[model samples]
Target: MLCSCGSRPDRTGARRLVTPLDERIAALLLAEHAFAPATPGFVGVTVELPAALTGRHQLRHGFLSPRSPGTAALSGPPSPGLEAGIARMADDLDAATSLVGEVTPGGVRVALEAGLEGGGPLGLTRRWALAATLAPVLAAAFANSPSPEGWRSTRQARHRGLPVLRAVSDPRRAWAAYVLEQPGRGGPGLAGLARHVDALRPPVAARGHLEIDVADRQPRDGWRVVVAVTAVLLDDPRAAAAVEEITAPLAAEPALWERAARDALSDPVLAAAARACFVEAYGTLARHGARRDLRDQVAEFTERYVMRGRCPADDVLDAGAGFRPVPR
Candidate 1:
């Protein structure tokens, strides 16, 4: 699985507010940190891994770029090493402030893209369906961005304009139709269509690999739990089968995504699916001999949040105060 995180810098004293990092400052930070060779607006570094872990896949690389004037985006594949590659990338971004003044990273947003097992037209269609089915459960389980509007994941609620994937027998035709539906997008042929697809931010985006964009930005190292549980559920054979069955009933629910973002686990149907999926993932991690630390993290998260029908956002909401950065 490939993972990416977006973090905004917190104001020194006002934790809820953010400091902007303009493109010039971003470029300078990239150069000072030696996260090269710089692309148009992004700087990246190659992350070396043991051949045993990488197998046939190429060495993983991490990228840092400014998502907006105030937010930095860090992305990389999951690390099989001692530390996650994304964490290291965040560290570099936190440390380097050569051109820009000192700034503390805050409010992380994470996305994980899982590659299809085998390449085929039918496989692509099935993968799209699976991603769509699992999106709401994952979103509800990991919800963190709480707002006064009563939504557990305000960030997700704001994505109403983005497309939602539906279970389709022919994803290619569906995708083509989706693209054409957008104004000024119909004229794009194959190459242009590829670019258009890259730009669209759907709950589940098909970019060869299925990009799951439902989860809110996790807090501090809580991101590990998000990555571990998601990877295990999607990549493990037994867990995948279990989740497919667990999420089947959710596909037909009207306004499921809206419910997931607003009510989170408070919704009975989503709560049950999330509970079942987490149980399956926890067991799969143990049986598959996943790292002890990762297994422990998942177990702790399941106990603290999933089992109780709560999420990270509940902690923030219950605190009854403005959002504060959790100690790293």
Candidate 2:
């Protein structure tokens, strides 16, 4: 992700993302949901759901329960009592000040991706499965990233791929999307995104969000099945500023993003658009009056993509996440 964003690299964050998630999950139990107290440096799990919805699910502790394939029979249909319980759980989940996501039915259940990070408490699953799910998301994140500051050529930046993920990952599977994205108001592919449907022992049937109804309509043309989103909290001032900056460039090039995968090389108009994009990005970075050293970075990248005409580094490193097109 750092590579794609041209973020100048924050090793501290990179280390935390890789190591702590493993250490925290490795020692915790999987069957029951749990929440550990957030220490100073680590993220604090604080989740906030919209007022109208009280989503349901189990809330288990991590350190105590067996973090393996386990099952519990849930009898009876949905009730108000159950609803209240789920609400409290969601509140608790969001209590983490930093970041943590919760499952609607937070207990051990089926969702291909197996874990989420909103509403509090992170998730754990087989390492390989986790990798598979996250790989696609990272790709999407990078692809959506636009030109960063301090580059000569904006070139084929990977930061703009966030919007079109649904198109490629699950082109035909809308039901799979709905459950996977239930947290985001019932979009498709959530089940597949979750990654635990097959692993549950005495497997339980997934409900509305998880179920892929044949009757549900397919995704719209460009919207597709959104597998990745560049979720930026508007409340955080810095994040809010980023939202302003990132969106300006991304919204400027919707056509380029859509064609990056299939037509990155094939489409002539798109190639021209990509080349022009490098010029625009670097021009903007320089206009911002940043240090010359930083603006020069953007200039160099512009030449690399627009003038030199090469495949983006992001493509060779991570293609699925690749969106910004350099001259190929």
Candidate 3:
């Protein structure tokens, strides 16, 4: 699970705009704190992961990037140690920005990547399809970025015009065709294809592992619930099967992604799908011996939001003018 968080400097009682200098200073602080090397450009820090955590030497380093002015993009491998990874990254970010700024509420973005089972080209294609099919449903379930525009996930709404990976019989070919049709002067060579792939921010991306980038930033510790539910639904066999069935009809639904970001659970079809997905994940977490606290958190989230066809965004909307987001 890779997470990106945006923060701003709070001077006195006012929120100050984050500057490039502030980002540089935070990067240096994070590098020193993590004992990692700081680099120029977007990706700022690279921390070496323990072999025990990564299970290999090749996938050793995790990255911390200041891709956006006020954002810290922390990328790492998936669970069983993903929660700890997120915690460490969060702590590093907090320590790094203590003298400069604080992580903003609703500014965290997450990308959950699942490895393809029975590793092969076919497995890769199948996993990509599954991730694509689940993207909108997950987005609706976890929508958090509320705004005056009346959209549940303003972050997701901003993804309009970006490439969306659809369920296809041959994803590899579809991806190649999509890349070729991109309005760029990029070459048709392998290097150019690589560049195109790196540049596009599709809902579901194939990077060895299938990465789902749909959920909005959760509030406070709510990110844990997002990761746990997403991980369970994709990783657990039974849950994945159920999710496949639940979301199958969504393929025929018009402007599904738009509906997911706009209406969120207010859309009856999406609400029904989210409710079932959460239930499946809740059950899978228990049967798979997940931590008790994590299970409880998922249960609480489901009861408070999913079951009622609401999400965290509703809380912010409900608060109206007096609304104060959760503090970092």
Candidate 4:
């Protein structure tokens, strides 16, 4: 049934609703990071951990920075439920910040910060979980910020562009005429309301390479790689032997990304892997009984995980550069 929404609704309850296929493709991104220490290459952990990102930079270069941070929301079935969910989400973000102290005391300081963003799917709980998913990604993307006093940045990330771009076309926005006939953020101007979304924005690149405190207590200049991992639940927790067994291998090979580069150069397996993710994502969308509203969302993530490519949403902010966000 279309329910009250002009379009069909997502049948799965938000929390229990991730598609199995998405979990599978997400496994690959994690595998890359897992492979980092072993294969003589870099392995990355992409999470929304502001502290880790901040700590690494502070220790290394005497400053901190964020690359690009993203925000996401899941719309629930209706208004009442949505409000409750967002309140809970807001509370959680506040709580998560407390963990920041752990890294800060250990020589390198880590600061974890959280904020609210806008434009959710509809329901509050669903949007809350989507927001939860985003937390880790924001952490992972944490990059360069200047010093103890956050720098004055002119850099703008596209996290703003995603919700704003909706101005051009969004069926949900098109349907807003019915929802917001009243006042406040209530009108068909949900498009305008979407404009009010928090848009988890991140700062631009570093002024220069920052320093990190090394074993000698000396400052070194270099960049830490941010690895984005997905689909942790897909591989039986242990079957991710591919990712699990890589730390040493990556260090051994030292240049394994060259193989990833080769995938673009000639390896059909790369495309095959990406194609498989798209197919699986579409299947997951269909299986979840969402054949339309979820298409763009799923496609964007698939590109991020499978192709190591930028999504249209991400492109709106930084073209291809801003994946990590560190608070300036």
Candidate 5:
């Protein structure tokens, strides 16, 4: 049995014993704080907390830094639902899937069903597009898995340079043409939204939610940074413009995503662009009364990487990394 005690009963009063595979994997992930599978698999969790502004730097470094305090999201197990979802999805899939950090089955990256406050659909879509534009730099900043299945430099090497899927350049056209035109599957209204998810490579908008898919699993801190930066960009268009200018040269590069995955901050262009984005985001956060600690953490990330010219991947590689084993 996956869970030895099976003491925790569900709402119906039935014990939920996980699959043996999941039980062992979860143990390693929980105890060792690191576990990688030879095949396509993930250890993930879904938080049910109400959405709020997160301090990404604190979250990332807290898990890594012994001195800093960690966030609730960073210190926990894959929820029962999330763990079961991974097992169910991995079983259902016939082909190798992408999206390593996802808990959704079949690697279908779906956001929790919730709408952004105060923003209409069109405005939300624009922010999603802007988020896609900045992903390459973020990818470089938070590159964690340098090796996936014996591949060097990136866990996502196979999927690199595949163009960020900006689903809708014009929000109106997207709603009418792409979204409405998409055929439905599960049910009514938006049951068919999944068809449009990967219509672009990374998918910009899905069922009215912004889908920002960059960075791999394990470090929620990197994910937090990406989300925070996206929110800041939405509020301050000036920061968005600065990010555009910094990344302009790299956007023109054909192998932009590949370069980010492989070279990370070591590449001069990506390092410079990442620095520019961090600076703009940091300034915007300060102006908006973001927590002092959060701002300081962001500054620390900037100093550690942009200032010194290194990425998390560099540290992993320097320490002699290898593939993590799937628990039996």
Candidate 6:
């Protein structure tokens, strides 16, 4: 969520507002059966709902979640006990502090259950593979962090060039073992998976679900773009093929992030590939009978970003108030 300073629009006031607002939001979501921790940086918080609502309602809840940030989840099987435990944890964390990390200018994460139509372990693996394949382009499209002091773009800029995790491409059992075995969570099992779910960021799979953590704090319109891009890549083989074609060559570039982060669409190759994916995604969405508004939003995002070589971060930078220098 964009942390606005209300009438007191300066930086200091914004910082002051974060703590009080974070605390208040934490309380409110608990009252409403949501789990959230008071975020530590910037003036934002994250409330997580146990289930995915319809698109508009989910966005509404996300808006409420920051106080709420748009840290929403897509559909998944019900997990009443897990939800309750998280809410309890959130309550404990809220009583302790109002600091949540990664509260940058451009920060948002939307997670969808990785389970696919076939409904089994293999289905889950397929879902993970698809998300892994499209992670880079989605990251580029949704890059929104740019420092006001002219420090290029994306707060999590490290994400741009980071190689895909080895586990993403491994066989299904291997992927499950990797996630289940991560030491910090616990000894491998359902309990371990639960502990690590929130800890592990998206494009990650655990306990039979996947989360796409590629987006950032975007304009409301950007949500539609994210949904569209995800649907096309995961559901449409043709679009995924096009995206794979584009990103395959980058596996060996020493500083590939420079192209995705600093240069963005300004890089000719990335631009061409991004546009192709967008076009193919649009067509795929159209044939699948997606809503007219959704199709248009995806098209608009494509033209505005892929074709024009601009991203949400560029708009933020142009606004001047969108960022501050990274703290040392």
Give the best candidate by TM-score. 3
Query: What's the ranking of the predictions by lDDT, best on top?
Result: 3, 1, 6, 5, 2, 4
Q: How close is candidate 5 to the true structure, as a TM-score?
A: 0.52
| lDDT for position 150 in model 3 | 64
lDDT against true structure, model 4: 0.25
Model 6: how large is the Cα RMSD against the reference? Answer: 15.5
lDDT (Cα, tens digit) per residue for candidate 1, span 1-328 = 0111244356664334223433343333323321111111111222211111111221124444444454554446434422354455445544334323453333333333333334332244455566678878888888887776667887567554343465665554555455445544312233444444555656665443445666666655566666556666665556666787788777678888788888899889989998999889889878878678878888898898888999889988998755533211
TM-score of each: 0.67, 0.24, 0.69, 0.23, 0.52, 0.58
> lDDT score, residue 232, model 3?
65
How many residue pairs clash in each candidate at the backbone level? 0, 73, 0, 61, 1, 8
Number of the candidate with higher lDDT, 2 or 6:
6
The sequence of per-residue lDDT tens digits that candidate 2 reaches over residues 1-328 is: 0011123336565522222222123112211222221211111111222122222343441111223333122212221222222333334433321222322221122122222322211221111122222222222222322222211112222222423222122211322332233332211132322243233211111221121110001111111111101111111223323333333333334544434432342345444433544444445444445346545644554454434443343334344442333432
Index of the highest-lDDT prediction: 3
Which residue pairs in model 5 clash with each other? Answer: 184-192
User: lDDT per residue, candidate 4, 1-328, as tens digits?
Assistant: 0111133336573333222222233233223221111111111111233343322232211123333342111111111221232233234334434434322111111111111123323222222232222222222222122112221111222121211111213222322232223233311222333322212122110001101111000011111111112221011123123222222122233222222221221234333433443444345445445435335544544555335532122232343343334232
Candidate 1 TM-score versus the reference: 0.67
**Global lDDT for candidate 5?**
0.46
Query: What digit string (tens of lDDT, one per residue) describes model 6 on residues 230-326?
Result: 6556545455556556655655545545456665666676566677778888898787786677788788888887789777877877778767564
In angstroms, give how far residue 161 of model 3 lies from its true place. 5.9
> Per-residue CA lDDT of candidate 5, range 216-263, in tens?
542333333443454454445566566656665554566767777777
Lowest summed lDDT window (length 10), candidate 1:
34-43
How large is the C-alpha RMSD of every model relative to the true structure? 14.5, 22.1, 14.1, 24.2, 16.4, 15.5
Minimum summed lDDT over a 10-residue window in model 6 is located at 34-43
